[model samples]
Structures are given as structure tokens and as C-alpha cells.
Target chain A: MAEPLFDRIALIGIGLIGSSLARVIRRERLARRIAIATRSPETLERARALGLGDAYSLDAAEAVQDADLVIVSVPVGASGSVAEQIAGTLKPGAILTDAGSTKGSVIRAMAPFVPEGVHFIPGHPIAGTEHSGPDAGFAELFEQRWCILTPLPDTDPQALARLTNFWERCGSKVDIMDAEHHDMVLAIVSHLPHIIAYNIVGTADDLETVTKSEVIKYSASGFRDFTRLAASDPTMWRDVCLHNREAILEMLARFSEDLSALRRAIRWGDGEALFALFARTRDIRRSIIEAGQEVDAPDFGRHVVAHHPQTPQPEEG
Target chain B: MAEPLFDRIALIGIGLIGSSLARVIRRERLARRIAIATRSPETLERARALGLGDAYSLDAAEAVQDADLVIVSVPVGASGSVAEQIAGTLKPGAILTDAGSTKGSVIRAMAPFVPEGVHFIPGHPIAGTEHSGPDAGFAELFEQRWCILTPLPDTDPQALARLTNFWERCGSKVDIMDAEHHDMVLAIVSHLPHIIAYNIVGTADDLETVTKSEVIKYSASGFRDFTRLAASDPTMWRDVCLHNREAILEMLARFSEDLSALRRAIRWGDGEALFALFARTRDIRRSIIEAGQEVDAPDFGRHVVAHHPQTPQPEEG
Candidate 1:
């Protein structure tokens, strides 16, 4: 109904996060013209097939030409290359940002190439599904989710406000913080969880004592929850681990130290210590639910209740 | 309308599994009379208030005096104590069973106390939620779930058949397994997942660089998945860890070994190994869904699509 927020906006990747951004931008009329680009021709064509953008390109430089905003949504490992390719092409006054999970490394990778006039802000949107690819995204991916923005010291206030406003319009609550702190926060919250999930699933897959078929059949007991995270896009997660090496390894060290203590408690039959740890963790889940970071449902409310005549199934995504 | 499967069934615990059994047994008329007992007076009172059983008691012997079946659904660590309490009072031809998560120790604990004519079967129902206690359960909890029964040698086939039928009527698919094998399978599928979840959540909570509030706020990114499993009943899980020590320790050793390799790959920026591991785990999730062990929803489909105008949210629980 009204004029779009930006005359031209370019999305440098069109996977789950990128395509979700595209869908929301298009749904809310946040951008009048959208250009999509990816390293892979097939993905670019798929993005075009999904009707995700006004224009599509295999070349990042070409995609960013004259764009009012350039959002790089590629794997964190590729940020430097994407920045290098688009450095000479990004419009003088355009806001250049990213949707990387790790802020410090992404900034380190992209900031070196940014020209003087372009605004460079690294943002991590704390939202996504395990699903990847253009077909996997919908317009509601960012709704009621947090988006953290890490701006450079000399960042233009007008540019930061505009980008903050853009994310808010896309239904995300914006939090501004230091890039290093953002990386540390995400290492614990995102990277370590993914690594632990992948590791445990890999462990189960390799166990001779437990048959793979058995693991698959009885997953509902608990293992399936980890599988959702382990099933995340390989390239995306791999890049995250590689890019956020220092913080991730630190978190991993802490995780292993704690796991060793748990192992000892179990081995020694120390039920008191184990129970205290388990009971304390329940408070965190309650806090997360109270903060609206999680839904208040048992077992994530996945199991449908068909056995009861009076009870209806709970609402789901 | 129809004769109940058992004349009187006594449940020796009033937690999630026990309460769910009580609800389903009533709904399906599997038991004409249900007697619920718990060690804790408060839990027994709560079970009575919820109408989970026809009769309630704080004494295990009093509950099982005239019952045709006695189902011990307490924490695994208390299996021996429960067996000792009910050994003298059980009816001669009654079936004595348990719904513990661990099988080998439960079998060891309860097998010695069974009366000559009574049948003793150890079962691990691969169904539950993160929630615990009487109010957290429902009739549909076991629907379409796997209920594994581990029976001793020289067991009565008639008794096993009747118990199998009881669970079948509760909407569970039954699997008969060796006690040791059941323990091994569950260590990989259930026990290890919960332990890993608890350990990771503990690790996040103890971090010096990241605030606990930040972990709670950004949990949706990945940490929330583990929080669900970590929030499980502390006494039950603590008992499980202690009772199933050998199998769990074996699984934990394997998990830590695999995690080391994964950490090495990340530290060395071995993208190929990381991508391969991540991609392979996706197939396991698909297999679990195909096997009817998991719901095929991304992010457990927790995020409802209130922000989308055209896209409808998928049917949910």
C-alpha cells in the first residue's frame, strides 16, 4: 500500500535464512526490488523458481550493483570471499550487513573489504529451523525472534537505525552488543549445542553394542530431539564451527569438563549430586518459557493425542 | 460393557508413567479396579485428587494385597526396595512388572523377590515427556509408542501374553527384548541423550563469559532442544544414571571419543569431515520419522506462523 522501505535490496545467499528474509521482505513490502545471488547456479535458479526476488544472479558483484542494501547470508566461511567480490560494487551509501551466526569472525572477514562510505554491521538473527534451502523457508521465520546487531565503532547512526528498523519490521527484536561478546554468547547458545548433537548422533551411529535400527526405532524416548539439531545444514554448521573456532573450543572444553563430572557421579552412584544438577536445569527451562523463548509444552508437544476422547491436541507451528 | 483385562491392577508409583498407565487403563477398561501407591504421601494425595486410580495408598504392600497385577513404576534405584515391600503381599497368580527405563538392573533387583507362582517381567516403555508427576501424564502418552518387555527365562507364556495384550490395548507396539540388550539399546537412544543434554545445559549455566540470562534468551537458536531433555524428572533420571551405570558409561565414553574427533576437525578447519558428519546425521532423523518414531517437523514446528498472511501453519499435536 505504501512505498517499500528500500528501492533495491540484494540477498547474497538464498538458503534457509536468506530465503526466509526474502519471503518476509516480499510479504511486508519491505523492498521494492530484490536481487538474489548464490555461488551455486542450481540454488540461484531454485530461488528464481520460488519467485523469491525481482532479479537473480550467479555473480555476487552483479547482484549488489546499485542495491540500497546488501545482505550477505552465506555460510560464515564464505563471508570474506563474498565481501571481496561485492566490495567495488556495493552502492556508496548502501548498508552492508550479514546474517551470520558468529559476529566477530564475520566482521573480521567482511570489514576489511568495506569501502569508506558503506555501513558495515554484523547481525545474527537468533531464529531458523533445521530445514535448509529456498523451499524450506516461509515469511514467519523471524517473527518474535531476537536479532543481534554488532556495528563498527564509526557506524553511521542513520544507517544503524535504518537496519534496526528493517529487522523490527521483519518482526525481530533488535539487541545491540559488542561483536566479541556476541560470538561468546552464540558459542554457548548455538555452536556448542550443534556440535554436541552432531557428536552424540555420530557416536550412536558408530556403536556396535546398539544397532542403528534400534536407535532409530526408540528415538522418541529422547534421541530424536538431538537429531533435529544434528539434521541442520552441513555446510552452514561446518562453517559456523570453523569460523567461531576460539569461542566454540572454549565452550567445548567447559562442556567436556562438566560431562566428566557427570560421568563420575553416575559411576560412583552419587544420586544426590545428579539430582541437584537435574533439578537446577529445570529452572532454566521455566525461565526460557517465561521469557517466551520457548513454547510451554511437554515433549515439545510433538505427540498427537488421539487416544483420549475429551482431550484435543495442543497447537503447533 | 466388557470385562476388564485385569480384575485389579496396582500401580506402585504415581509419576508420569504410572499416572499415564492409570489413565489409559481406566479409559480402555483394562482394569476393573486400580490401586495407586507411592512412597511420598503428597504424591499419593495428588494422584487421588487427579482421580488417577480407584484406590490409593502410601503402603506398597497394602496396595498390592488383592491385585491381579502389580506394576512398579518407580525410579529404577528403588526397584529392589519395592520388590521387598510387595513380595509377601502379592496374590499367587498375579503378574508383577515394572515400567522402568533401565532393564538389566531392574531385572536383577525385582527377579529375586518374585513369588513362585507369580510372573515377573521387566519393561521399559519408550514413551514419556519432559514433564513428570501425576498431572503431567495423559491417556495418549503411550499411543503409537514402543513398549519393550524383557522377560526372564522359564517365564509363563500365558502371563506374558496377557501383559502384552494390556500394553497393546494401551496403544503401544510391543517389543520383547533381552534385559541386557534392552539396557544397551536404551543407553544409546535414551540415557546418553538425557545425560548429554543435562551436561550441556550445566556447561552453559556455569560459563563465566556468558550470562545465564543470555543463555535463556537465545536458547531458541539451539540450546532449547537440550533444555527439554534436561528438564526431565530429576529423581527418575538420577536413578536411571545410577542403575544403568555400565551401559551408560560405555555410551558416554563413545560419545566423548567421537566428540574429540569432531573437535579436532573443527580446530583444524576440516570442513569436509564436518560437512560429512552433519549430512549423514540427517538421514537418521528421516529414518526415525519413517519408522514412526518422530514427527517430521522442522524445529519441532514450535514456531506458529501468526506473522504469515498466506502460509498456513502445519497440522500439529
Candidate 2:
């Protein structure tokens, strides 16, 4: 429909985010040629079989060579290594970006290796599923979701605009913030939620009074929601916890403190306090729904769509 | 299509669960006459406006008079009082049931006032959305979900059979569980999850570094899932916490212990432990999906189905 955003786009570590981007780029004709690369040859083979890109390679450097755009979609911990591997081969004018969850760490890891003319923009697409791997991706993952870019102080405006344009074309609403703020924001919204989910699910899994079978059977109540987050890529979350240590720990401390207060309120049977907190949080969900950030459907219609996509979407009333 | 399950059905407490049951019963033609009673007159008026019941009243006793089936769908704390109010008026062969979240509490609270020939079956439909009130209900909320009944020893088999048949007709698979065992099972599966969600969301809302705006904006990352559970009816959850104290506290102890272990692993950077726990939880999610308990779409298809359901259920992918 329009000219390709870049002549050649290199995508490193093609997992859910990477594959989704590849699909959107292909569907929207956002790139002239695509080079898909990952450390795992099996994943590479899968990507090629899916015909996600024009070229597939295990060599990150080879994938970025002569490419106008390089998007790193690996776990946050791998960003530094991938950047190191591709820094030398990246074209002088290439724009380098990432879709890692944590921002400060990604910038620290990739900033040192960028060539003089290469635009190194750190970003995190505030979208994903518990499922991973290339096959789990779809073209519409980014639609109406936020794409946060944490640009450096001296970052080129032209490169920033181009990258923002690319993401917008791929169906994301873009926002730029400082790297530190991004990490702090995500730590509370994403990292803390995942860590807490993993913790709670682990707690339930280890319970002897209530067997795991019971937990799994009645998960629809609320426990299943935590399981989805807990089921996220362990490697990615671990890296996020470690890399975004300060912000996460800060959030964790606040969370623990607030939870202690709640525990006390419950112990004392303080209905008023509990009611106030619960009521306040209800408004937040209303805001989220009104803002179009969440759906009102039970289980978000994911189960229905996944297993019964051919079936008509059920009416609410 | 068939004879109504009950000549007249009375529902006390017109909240999310109550209203949903009313809608389902009406849709399935399970009751010829629906009489709704609630503690709050405001709620009664809302239920009337929603046309949730054929007759609306504030007096539980009056509502249950001459009714063949009376369902108390109030918070567990009010179950005893509602039972006391209606016990004298319940018809000789009427079925008295409740849709409380906690089975043991409901049974204990209402069992004392049960009339000789009337059946008091404690039931819980393991289905809901975060939203509460009459406006939040729909006829299809119970479709393909589980409705658990914890019948006391010596309970009338005929009454149980009729209630089970009614739930089945409303599109729910029914299961019978021992009251105490049901409490323990739901502690981990439902109660504990809600507690954790409320705790984490409260935690996020109280953070000094991460503003509430940030939490709401980037909630799609993972935090939003917790909000759904946290946004649940406060009175319902608070009553659950107070009524199911022992089971909830026991589960909380186990959760805290497990969390300590996870905290240790994170502190020591034990990637293996983190990875193992994370991997194990993933299987639970897979099982949930296979069990048709969870939606399979990425991020719960919240964005795609944000619009109020107007069409027939879309073909499930």
C-alpha cells in the first residue's frame, strides 16, 4: 500500500514479539526485504518454514550487515550479547532498536556497541502473551497497544521519528520516555505483576492442604489469571527481575508493605478499610476499560477465539 | 421448551452472582415466576429496572413465601440472616439454595434454620466477571462453566437432582463436593487468588515511585489481569475473607513460605530454581487450556473484544 519503511530489516531472536512484527511487516508491506536471525537453529528453521523473512541466519552480524533496520527481540539479558555481535556489521546509517521488557538495562547493554552513525533506540512493546516461540505470534498483537521507546539524550530526532513511524505503521501507539522512567514504570506495571504472579502460583503449587488438582480445576475463579502471567517465559522474567533490580525491589518493598497493611486490616476485621481499597481499585478497572486498555469479556474472549474462532462471538446479553 | 424448573423462584441479594443467575434462569425458562429480594432497596430498584425478576421486594421472608425454590445469593456473612428470615415462609417441599463463594460457611450459616422437608443445598457457580451489580450480568455467563454444590448429609436426593438439572439446563456442568473439602479446595483455587490479586493491586496503587497513571497506562504488560480480580465485589470478597478465615490463613501461610523460597532464589540469582518453578507453572496453564478453563488468545483477546458483545459469538479461532 505504501513504500517499504526500510530496504532491509533484520530481526534477531524471533519469538512472540519478533514473529508478530514479522507478520505485521509482511502484511502491511513495511519492509522490502527481511532477515530473520536467532541463536537457536531450530527456531530459525521454524521461522524459515513459516516464510517469515527473505533470509534466515544464525549469525546476528550477517543478519544486520547492510540492513537499514535491526530489531532485537531476545530476552533482556541477551540484548548486550546480540548488540555486541552485530555492532560491527551494522550499516553506518542503520537504526537499531529492541523489544526487551526492561529499558534501562537494554540501553546500558546496547548503547556501548552502537557505531557512530547508527541510531540505537531502546524500546519495549507493552504487549505479549504467556505463550512464546514463533508459531505463537499473530499480526494483530500490537494493535492499539503501547510501544514505549526510551531514547537517549543525544538520540537523532530523524531516527527516532522513523522508528516511531515504523511502530505506528505496525499498529502501536508510541510513547517515548527516559530509560530510567521506563524501567520504573514497567517494574510496577509489568515486572512486579509477573514476579507476584510467579510467587503466588508457586505458593499455590506448593500447598498440601489444597492439592494442585483442585487448584487447576477451579482456576477459573481468579487463580488462572495469575497462572497466565506466571506461565510467561521464565528466562525473560528472570532477566527482567535481575536487570531491573532497583525498580523491582522498590516496587516489591512497597507491595510487601501495602500487603502487610492489608493483612493487618483483614486480621482486625476492618471492613471499612478493605471496602475503601477495593472500591478505589474498582474505579481503576473502569478507567482501564473506558480507556480501551482492556476488554469487558470474561477470560477476555481468548479461550473462545483460540478454540472456537470459527464460532460467532457470543453476545453479552 | 419444557416445563419451568420451578413454579416460582425467589432470589435474595441482587449482586453480580444473583443477577447473573436471574438472567440465566430467565433465558433458559427455568422458572415461571422470579421474585427478587435484596437487603438494599437501591439494589432492588436496579434489579427491577433491569427486569431481572418478575417481582422485586426488599423483604426476604415475603419474597420466599409460597415459592417452590428460594435462592439466597448474598454475601456469606448475610446467609444466616437471610435464612432466618425465609425459613418460616419456605414451602414444605421448596428447595433452598445459596450461591455463596464459600461452601462450608453457607452451609453452616443456613443449615440451622432449614425447614423439615425443604432442601438446603449450598451451591457456587464457578463463573464471574470483575464487574458487579445487575447491569453486569448476562444469560450466557454460566455457559460451559462449573457449578459446584456441597450438599449436607441426609439432604433430599430429589431436591438435589432438581437443582442439578436446573444448573445443567442453564449450561453448567455440576459437581458435588463435601462442604469442608470444598472450602479447602476453593481456598487455594479461588479465595487465595483473589486475596493475592487484591494485595498486588493494592501494592501497585500505593507505590511512591510508580504513579497510578503509569500503572493504568502500561497495565497490559501483566498488572491488568490482577485488576480484574481485584475489581471484584468488595462486600463479597470481604465476607469471603471473614467467613473462610481458617482456610484462607492456612493458604496464606503456605504462600508466604513459598514466596520466601522464591525470594531466596532471586536474591541468590539461582536461575535454575527460578527457571524450574516458572517451567512447572507453564504446564499448569497448558492443562488449564486443554481443560477448556482458559482462553487461548494472546493477552486474553481483551483488545479485540473490547466492544460490547453485539454479534453472535465470532467463530473461535
RMSD of each: 2.6, 3.2
TM-score of 2: 0.93
| Model 2 interface DockQ | 0.55
Per-residue lDDT tens digits of candidate 1, residues A188-233?
9999999999988999998877789999889999999999899898
Chain A TM-score for predicted structure 2: 0.95
Q: What residue runs in model 2 are displaced by over 4 Å at the alpha carbon?
A: A298-310, A313-317, B306-317
Model 1 whole-model lDDT (C-alpha atoms): 0.88
> What shift in Å separates residue A289 of candidate 1 from its native position after superposition?
0.6
**Residue B20 error for model 2, in Å?**
2.7
lDDT of 2 at A95: 92
lDDT of 2 by residue, A1-103 (tens): 6899999999998999999999999999999999999999899999999999999999999999989999999999999999899988999989999999988
What candidate 1 gets wrong by more than 4 Å, as runs, is: A1-3, A305-317, B305-317
True contacts kept of 1: 0.84
